[model samples]
Target: MAERHLEIEQKYDAAADFVLPELDGLPGVASAGEPEVHELHASYFDTADLRLAAHGITLRRRRGGTDAGWHLKMPAGTDSKQEMRAPLGRPLVVPARLAGLVAAYTRGAELRPVATLETRRTVVRLLAADGAELAEVADDLVTGCGPDAEPERWREIEVELKGGTPELLKAAGKRLRKVGAKKGKSSSKLGRLLGEAVVPAQAAAARAAARSRIAAATSNGKGPGITTGEVVLAYLAEQVEAIATYDPKARLEEEDAVHKMRVAVRRTRSALRSYRPVLDAERTVPLGPELRWLAAVLGEVRDLEVLRMRFAEAPAFVVEDLEKREKAAYRRMNASLREPRYFKLLDELDRLILDPPLAGAADRKARKELPLLVTRAWDRMAKDYASIKSADDPDVARHETRKAAKRARYAAELAVPVLGVAAKRVVKDAKRIQEVLGGYQDGVIAMEHLGTAAKRTKVPAEAFALGVLYGKEQCEALAARDHLSTTWSQTLGPSF
Candidate 1:
């Protein structure tokens, strides 16, 4: 249901300025391009606080343009944005996905039209050396209208650089800046047209409520309440950002990008668990199960990713060495890596993410309110680690320790984006903890399997080999535990 477009549009102050003859050959009209430009008018919709702009997003309804409908401009790093348009229906309502995206920033707020503007435009083309048009440049006479009868007109240039880097933009912009073609004062066309009406109202209230909610969440259950509202909102915020950030990475098929984004899905569910007291678990209850389903759906390629990493690091000396006692030890790992169970796991992960049971969080944006589940979660993170550390069974302790690491990692991640450095230190500590526990757990499982297989085969040579591997694992586990102690002391201090 997600869609995107790489939009390229340029604005200009005057038609003359747009028509400078700087080339031996040009595109579109060849000699003199079509001067025809539609008179455009658009109504900008934003929260009273202009939440959309704060998130580097813009949404508006426009008429008189060739493509008239609702347009949502998503941030495309600096100086650019990906514009997504949804056609207006009989009801003229916003698309569900588009609205959901905005809801993350707006929170529990309303979207309304604050201002309108009209544009008189002429369009021209940028051409390659062969007279092929590379991109278009639009010249606009912006007339600020509505909310005031005495409307004002201004001139500016718009360029949608085709197949050009921001660096080329820099070069061209420098040339234009010499002639006062500096960066557009407003972030978007709607902003320039209706700047006076929207910005101030959106700034003051700011992140006030979000900050309070986050703080309360951090202190929840110890007298101060951490609302499920806080945790859920925080989780939603991160997921929305993940969706936005990973869009390009998904398009490019970056290694582990999909899986990384999928982890955000788990993190959201984990927050739900860690902060269970805040939400109507009955209402939000089904979400955990659904999250599990989705996680499975996203697991396919991710499992492959894990295997690839494992195989890359798995030493040849550790596998299939018949003359060496470690031969049987290595063979089992290699055979397990190639098993169909691996494929089954991958398939399961994919189905869940693509089609989650989203019943728990139904159209959550409107006329819906939930309490905070914050304090208990933070407290749980601390207690959970302690419980893991104190587990009687060493194997179970290792697994629980990993679980605790994940909890801490999730907490640190949510905070890092909002609180910055202090949160980052927590993430680093948690990651070190995860590494220690994970290695020990992996070694334990591997050693146990090889030991069982060797005993079943009744091969003294295989048993001896497995015993040696088992000894190595025992040593490694102890080392990991010792390393974890040092890391925990250094980063988390004695209190941890």
Candidate 2:
């Protein structure tokens, strides 16, 4: 089992001649304990291309430290990381648990020892007036070697918070700066050792060129100053990053993680479908089904999660059954995440971002091209809304309308960067419609689940309770259906 916690710390580079500063008078500190010396060795592992380091993630197995183990540190926020630790089990092979967490980044790439670091350290503990340790300051002299690279040596300082506040961390950094310490060039030892390998050179150059082009176009005062392709690609890149970011959390079954990853998949698929004019359909069209496949996998888990929550107030047996089903769904989801099909989808998304297949309209100014696309999506939604209003059975029509509204909402959101307020208004209207219909759909599903539970249970009281819940949900579903026409009239007053 892996232990997880947040590691909030600051790192600074100092020359060999620099002296360690006294930390006794720092904020929230009454005294500094005597220095303790230790020698530590760590081997950092990543793919041949260093994918993990590029994303600010570090995986290492270390020895000769109080926290000696396999540590996987992932970015949590500025100046902090979520660190998961496992006991030192093997010397060479990466731990299975840690490797699984990083599968999203590795994508089947073989993990190898990319760098090794040996550190001679002196540590002092800063303590509060009551002798509670607030933070530890480590002055390290490091000798690091990367694959096929010469050994390099440097000196740095790290202040890792234990029971200290962020302000105290800032104060410690200030004290270190007064003694000539500067912010470290890289965030981690592996990053400093691997250097440009952490970020592929070709990708870096492309980003730089894109920035230059955008800057030149802005200065020229051209119409909207950006192309539709650029706007669409930016949105696609954001969704891709979100999917990777949430993959590990989803695998761990963390709260809301699966839903977030599913949303990213939906947003990516929606953008591709809605902006087909600006993108090459031959290259992007097939991705829709692939994305939908992944979304359905995640949706199975998410729907069960919602069902579990909805029945929290039901009988214990009902809640337990729902939980067992949810767990089984999660197991299926985890297996799907590790499938080659999912990895291929991720790789295709990356390639699409790096070398976008743009169509003829991609070169058009975004402000002009995007509104037309958004209007088309709005028109599609309006068509569905019309069907809902006239249909004899609105239940089936409402599901289609909800899906259409979602597509329209995603289209408008993508256009917001270029269209601003007008696009925002369309997004608001589409979101409202999506929410209303979505609630109705959830109610319908809940009623069905309740009905099933009522039939399966042997107990009379439990069956009666399930029956009452089913009736309540059916009434709510009908009410939502009744309210839909009025919502459409108010929101769909004038199409974009």
Highest TM-score model number: 2
- Give the worst 10-residue stretch by lDDT in candidate 1: 366-375
Model 2 per-residue lDDT tens digits across residues 357-465: 9999899988788889998998999898888658988777888889989999999998776676788889999998998888899999999888888878999999888
Best by lDDT: 2
lDDT of each residue in 1-496, candidate 1, tens digit only: 4455776543334333444334213222233245558788777677776767655577877787667877888766666688767776433466665665554355546777655768786666555545555555666778766444467677776767665445444544455555645567776766665565555422223223444556564556321343334434545555634643553343334566657767776786776565454445554565567556546645544544443343332334334322243233333422332344433432332222323223333223211222111223334545655675567775676576677677667755654433345556667777787788777766665566556556565656656766666777678867776676666666551111
Cα error of candidate 2 at position 186, Å? 1.0
lDDT per model vs. reference: 0.55, 0.87
Q: Estimate each model's TM-score.
A: 0.50, 0.94
